[model samples]
Target: MALVAVLILTLLSLGIALSGTLTRLLLVVVPYAVFTLFLAGVVYRILKWARAPVPFRIPTTCGQEKSLAWIKTSPLESPPCLWGVIGRMALEVLLFRSLFRNTRLDMGQNRPVYPSAKWLWFFGLTFHWSLLIIVLRHLRFFIEPIGPCITALSSLDGFFEIGVPTLYLSDAAMLAGITFLFLRRLIVPQVRYISLFTDYFSLLLILGVVTTGLIMRHFFPADLLQVKNLALGWVTFSPFVPQGVGTLFTMHLCFVFTLLVFFPMSKLMHAGGVFLSPTRNLANDSRIRRHVNPWNAPVKVHTYEEYEDEFRAQMKTAGIPVEKE
Candidate 1:
């Protein structure tokens, strides 16, 4: 669900293991295999997308396009240049500009009224950002000499200073976001009608992962030294399961692995897909430049001159006017 951020968790969960052979298989071999599968699958999908042909400039323009010199154009919406397209893509990718602009149509007394429904965007953004932060925080385990930036981020995320373990704002935000999104599917008539099993499954997977992780951190703490060593061992290509890491963490880990293995084949690939999409990546200069289909075969045209030459004898016999006599 969180995309490539799952890479960090694969390292973190190296300590959650079973018996001798099973421990090596689950904690060590499984992480490597799943991560490998995730990476390969994602790359194959992206490359497949890249190979697909775009026949025309079909950018999803939202404003005035570049035409006459005097006409004002919305650069962000109808991006006409490379820089404008890049800027538009940056905003859409980082801030979800298009989603932020989402509107909902409401039937007033007898008329239609379009209103802002920003809560969906807000919750979606919150969930994703929090997930990203949590994933980044786990990098402290993988890297021996942890970067200052990672430490700073972790400190900032848990700066509330609420409890003995220090409650993380990201944890709270992620839980609230996931709950709101899940409830929306159940409560909203339109959303409920369209929601699929996969949609609910994804949310539940993330919720399960977050719930189990929170339990491990607060209620039943994992041995930090062993966990860190296991993580570092993964980083160094030598892995061993450390004893005393509970089954709860293992359960939490299975959820992460499920999400990872499911990610490349599922809708979660939108993280990678958004970049390859012609509608988002292309510049809106359709009127200015002709986008001939690259796949078109070479076409031969019979020139009027050639036709005139070929029919000259017939034209002369028929007493018809001819370009050349």
Candidate 2:
């Protein structure tokens, strides 16, 4: 199903590009209009979620929180204060810090689900960092004359200078990581059943984006200058739709736009929602004071006198304490 969907999308996009019926003006107009809707939807959803009331301080704790004066606390794991929470969030966003400590267990014969899995942390780290680098490097496309920062990143990324077209570490790492993640889903029975169309679709979309991009660059080379010109014009609002840009590029661009449009509506909103989540952002000070839900409803209560009135004889016979005889 996932493959069929992608193929259908690819064919449709190629047809659109080849039609020549959709004018340059319309193609240029459509992407930006879609981008606007995408941006608006993202902002609206985020704001709506942010307004939800979290009545209780319910930050998730994995390690020792601030308790006794003598006991040391794991500030990063179980943040007890605001600063600690910020630090934890930073690490999580930038480095996928918590995932570094991830562990997996497997069931064994005559024993509990009691054994090991390989180093998922390393692969996860490699993939994320490489993706970040790739995103940063692409900054050159949307900017005029390309900033020195981008130049520096390009230099550092291809510092090895191995061949005619210098090798990028990110290209290899991204492929390896995507392959592992996909395999992990297919090979693991539990994950395979639980996986939905969206999960598979998202993976395929990203893989297609990366594969098509690589092919465009290393194999069937497109004019980088023209590509950059088109990107910059789009970014600057003085849009220019260039000719001779291949169908593959259009399909890739459409997928990118599709991902962006789908992002806020899907689980990908976790990127922003993470910041607003009480589970990650709140201080864990449960030991320091009490927290009561302000929105809790009033409940009927029976006083001691009423209790005594109801069971006075029984209480006296049983020799139980009574406020009044």
* lDDT for model 2: 0.80
- Residue-wise C-alpha lDDT for candidate 2, range 11-38, written one tens digit per residue: 7777776776553644488779778978
Clashing pairs in 2: none
Residue 308 of model 1 has an lDDT of 90
Tens-digit per-residue lDDT, 178-225, candidate 1: 999999998999998998777877777788799888988899888888
State the displacement of the C-alpha of residue 291, model 2, in Å, after optimal TM-score superposition. Answer: 3.2
| TM-score of each prediction | 0.89, 0.85
Off by over 4 Å in 2: 23-27, 113-118, 297-325
Superposed by TM-score, candidate 2 places the C-alpha of residue 282 at a distance from the truth, in angstroms, of 0.9
The true-versus-predicted C-alpha distance at residue 79 of model 2, in Å, is 1.1
